[model samples]
Target chain A: MNRLACLVVVIGMALPAFAQDARKSGFDYMGPDTQAMQKDDLANPGMLSVLEGETLWNTPTGKAQKSCAACHGDATQSMKGVAARYPAMDDKTQSAIDLAGRIIQCRVERQEAPAPQREGRELLSLSAFVGRQSRDMPISPPQDAKLAATRAQGAALYSARMGQLNFSCAQCHDDNAGGHLGAAPIPQAHPNGYPLYRLEWQSLGSLQRRFRNCMSGMRAEPFAAGSTEAIALEAFLMERAAGMKLETPAVRP
Target chain B: MWRLLGLLAVLVSFDASAQTLVPYRIENGAITQSLTGVKGDAAKGRAIVVERQKGLCLLCHSGPFPEERFQGDLAPSLAGTGSRMSEGEIRLRMVDSTKVNEKTIMPPYYRSEGLERVAANYKAKTLLNAQEIEDVIAFLVSLKDDTQK
Candidate 1:
């Protein structure tokens, strides 16, 4: 498993060979400095939020007077590999819900508490905490035997050209993955990292934040944070990243 | 009769300058030069080509830009395009390169036909306007090979 194979053939007219089965995460493409940062949990800036999330996880403030651990027990044991199976089909909603969406849902329905903020500070803390539970685990987002119609819709949305640029995700990420987008290497976008720290962002953030940034980069009006379109795209990304190791709280350049 | 003629004159002027949706014809992976009726501004074209917000050409295509620190290494360079391709071929490519290579990653900057999975908001518009297309063409046409530059 030579990861250097991914770096071959980038200079000439020849495109890099696609190893679709490799399941490479975006973190694999980061600079050594970034890799070092993410590898060190103590040094990673994202860990700030993870620490906050740990405290939040232990504190019981919901109307039902229960913490995430009350029913689930210690997250280290109970939440292990949980993030790997997200954007899952919510039995009640009957639609896909990512890790963040599922957590918000739990707050409302299970805990009988007020709806948590969408990508708010608290939510990000909790998401990063929960996501960190599955670090190094292989991603395997709900592989229901039945193909989801919503997944098909998600495929359409992924390929759709939006914004003033008339560019689709397929135009760049799919067709030209591993290609350079102005000195910036465009890695095959696997949503394995979330609550990841980005140099441009200068902080740890959720996948939804990155999605919004990309949408605006195309000069297109972005979908709302928790809208069906955003969720669908999330599901599609999670599916695309299946089998890749989760790098939650990963660092990026 | 004088007033009627004057009103008609105003209406005709408005229609002539209006930016209507234009149609393009593709034949054998090329669009012949017969259909285009546009004048280009190379200076403006230079700006458009480098603009990440709109043209976004730099996202994939590397070109001669000493001032800009970053240039892509994805698609072929646009530096010596004039020496390599005819204006007509360049025009066709810019409008819709997929006509020549269906699987090409380059977006059709000036066409809206036969595209599947386009966002609803941008359904009615082409990526670049006719004048912008002409400007880009003029800029490319002015690119005289590296020896000449």
Candidate 2:
């Protein structure tokens, strides 16, 4: 009898891992009209930023006056699958850095140009352009020992309660997803379609901006832009969204 | 005299904005004493629960509200709560659910302190005032129909 009980416990522990296979991206929860809009680049408004980024890629600026094409020589070939593997380790910082962060670093260090303001049109456009290269590819977070601590911190932050509402991200996205929160359906909170446009904003925005919006909605203080906590959360989200297809420059409502 | 009157008006306005809440006592996981000392109106309580910008109760709880098309499923259904629990028990849960379950997702409708990272505009403000808490309790205790579950 005890052996049977032990076997049941072991199987119960394994159930959630198997359940994760059925995980759905926020895309699945979107209305059909929005999905159709994402499928057609012509109809999607986010493509404008991607086109701007493409122009910026070939144009030279700063003291070096060297375009990204001069070093990388065409984003289509050199940048494929690159966005899928971020927030990767930055050698200088010895911490996780997101795709946007990496772009700012390159502009400052390699191009000898000043870093663009966070969430600025320049940054958003560049990120959207680069991320567009990895569309439809699976998210592939790195499996390095160095990134483990940051990933763990991110996971903790996802579950930690904050704000006057005392809501943790997991409580809504994990525990009660598919339910309605006053007319709006609570999605699973995947980070797959970042650098994507939100209908609510009527413009393109980053994942960090979304985080701040949610934190404020919960009546809590928002994490600073580019803070370690925000990066850590991004790292964890990418890992959680591992195997999900990228939807860069995607449209959402 | 004008200066003195202006000073008094400023103090009064400041006091109103500060929102000094009523006092109450807790006993055995329940606030046996009422915060406002006056009985609450059940009709107004029902309206508050359903309103999106007020109690926000429908955001995380389903109840016997047929008109509400988008009730949540995060917490227990509010139906038949009066049949299962006493008035004081419900009042305590409204005041602060963390006292019962440390990790409850249900926001404390009446608590105003010890919260972390609260937004600047919302600091030191409870989700519901003391009288609002009583009104909600009055509405909840009236729901004695277990069949609604």
Could you give the TM-score of chain B for each candidate, in order?
Answer: 0.77, 0.85
**Per-residue C-alpha lDDT of model 2 across residues B37-126, encoded as one tens digit per residue:** 889889989999999788889888889999888887767889998998989889879988886677788898877677778888888888
lDDT of 2 at A246: 93
For residues A184-226, write the lDDT of model 2, one tens digit per residue. 7888888888898999999999999999989988989999888
How many steric overlaps are in each model, in order? 0, 0
Residue pairs with backbone overlap in model 2: none
The TM-scores of chain A alone, one per candidate, are 0.88, 0.92
* Error of model 1, residue A73, in angstroms: 2.1
**DockQ agreement of candidate 1 with the native complex:** 0.29
lDDT of 2 at A182: 66
Model 1 bad stretches (over 4 Å): A1-21, B1-19, B22-39, B112-126, B146-149
Model 1, A134-243: lDDT tens digits are: 99998887777433766777788889876655568887788777888887888777788897889888887777788788877765677778777877887788788787
